[model samples]
Target: MLDVKDVTRMFGTKAAVDRVSFTVTGPAFVGIIGRSGAGKSTFLRMMNRLTDATFGQIMVDGTDILALRGAQARAWQSQCAMIFQQFNLVPRMDVASNVLHGILNRRSTMQTMFNLWPRADIIRALEILDRLGIAEQAPKRTEALSGGQQQRVAIARALMQDPKIILADEPIASLDPMNAQIVMDALKKINVEDGRMVIANLHTLDTARRYCDRVIGMRDGRIVFDGTPDQLSTGVARDIYGADASFNESATSTAIPTDATADRVYADAMLS
Candidate 1:
């Protein structure tokens, strides 16, 4: 569904993303994993046009996304929902209203300014909350929810657009283990049930290996490994994280279950 060819982003002397090339052909869950400064987040941002790439091209379906401007770009971006590590919910807004934010582009300036979403829009937002298992909280202010509930609200908001692609940049980075599992399960359910293309930048290889159909490993801005979780060998993990990678036998022996799914996904990744 998305094609990135030789994508490079540079800021003066520093190169954030370098010659990254990859493709997503259908509704699949894909994970982009790397250590800090590896450019995973920058690459995701480029796809959403949050930051313009210094060079290279990103195509959605068949359209060159970078070529879109103004209204066109906004329209396309609305179809590509972004979930951040920090749930960026408006504190004062009700949960349903926050989710409705996804459709801002479709509203008139006056309608949005006054927060007057159409009745149908409100119904749709409530339905999304129900599907996400947070319907009861819809009338509550965002500030009244817990972190996990807040993130779910963020996902509900993203779904309100009926987005074709979902980009989650470290969605579980701030949560505890149980909450992380809840969030990952929600994402996995969306991918499996709705077949929405989900791409996430994850800090732990465990999550990627567990939930992603394929894992793309990055190092110093280039793709070093890309394949199924089962195809990823110990050697590959070593290469991606060095000998001290957290998923090592000793470090991961006890926490295996929490990361088992990610381990399997990475293990299944192709050797290429």
Candidate 2:
């Protein structure tokens, strides 16, 4: 279980994350949606300790994550793997090597410095690539693969961590519609099949509705809505995005049924 209590992050006098509180128990595919600067990224970063909260406590299971230090803090971070919009990978390295990097934290300094991976770990990396449907690309350079394939390699890397939770920060922002669907499907498969929790900062509403079991809507720095996808009515979306917002651009652009007709269909589905 993950419990966030009165979490707030201040940058000088501005509060990026304002007294946010929520509890998550059991595995779930959670979508965090909001316009730019809604604190969605900040909140996820705080959970992984990439950004520190100015105040409040974050408890994962029975541990107060905010109080961890040094090696303990590093270990905590490893337990919560992060996937970025950029698909951070070593461009020059082979895909399999990039996936193996996930286990560096668990290895000795000399072993890591020498890039010495155990034979078992090498086989495990290959298995993960096969599971993600990218086994053939393992011997290729990471940068040589297409955007969608690279993202799958990134997912394979995260699996090497054996994380309790996966936090994806606007993971599909740079991909075209087809590639985006592939990435989202991969994420959903991870959550449903592996039973690991997935919390993604999503840009498109249709993607959220299609992939997430639970949706968390944020406005400014506060949670405006928290419920199942069916509860995310058009009225609720308007409240989340605002009255004059461009729905076609933000909500339907990368969505499935990507046609002019989908506009009304998406609107009706969201509103109904």
Candidate 3:
């Protein structure tokens, strides 16, 4: 379980995330949607402690994680893994080593310095890659893989931490439509199969509706809507996106059809 109470982050005088409070139970896929300047990214960062919340209580189970310090704080971070837009892998490094890096916080200084990973860690990394359907890429340099594959490697690295909550900041924003679907599907599978709670910051409304069990829409640093996917109607989306009537909701969708029939439907919609 997770509880974010009155979470707020201020930049000098401006509040990026203001008085945001929400509770997320175990093993659900939650999507945070909004326009460019909404606090979605900042909120995810705060969850992973990549960015500090000016004032808030972030509770996991019954404890306030925000109060942790030193090794304790680092342990909290290890349990709450972050996946970023840029993959964040060492390009020249082999994929297995990159995933093994996730456990550096728990290793001795000399072990990390010499890049010596325990046999158990390496085996677990391979297992995670296998589960994500990228096991074959484990021996290849991360840079040799395609964009979609690299993102999967990043996911494997996150899994290496055995995180209870996975926070993704625009995991698919840089990918093409097809690749976007793949990454989202991977996150969904992690939530369903591995029982990991996932919170992703997404710009595409259609993708959110397809994959998210719950949707939280942010506007100008505040949550404007919080409900299930079905509750997020077109009108509600417009409010979150600040879109006027001229905004065709489909235009905001990043989905691309894989079948011929669906492709025709998408094409016709474009023509119409």
| Residues forming the 10-long window of minimal summed lDDT in candidate 2 | 256-265
Task: Write the residue-wise lDDT of candidate 1 on 127-192 in tens digits.
Answer: 999998999999999999988899999999889889899999988877767777888899999999
Best by lDDT: 2
Per-candidate TM-scores read: 0.90, 0.93, 0.91
- On a 0 to 100 scale, what is the lDDT of residue 68 in model 3? 79
Poorest stretch of ten by lDDT in candidate 1: 247-256
RMSD of 1: 4.1
Clash count per candidate: 21, 2, 0
Q: What is the full ranking by lDDT, best candidate first?
A: 2, 3, 1
- In terms of TM-score, how similar is model 2 to the real structure? 0.93
lDDT of 2: 0.87
lDDT of each: 0.83, 0.87, 0.84
What's the C-alpha lDDT at position 253 in model 3? Answer: 50
Candidate 3 or 2, higher lDDT: 2
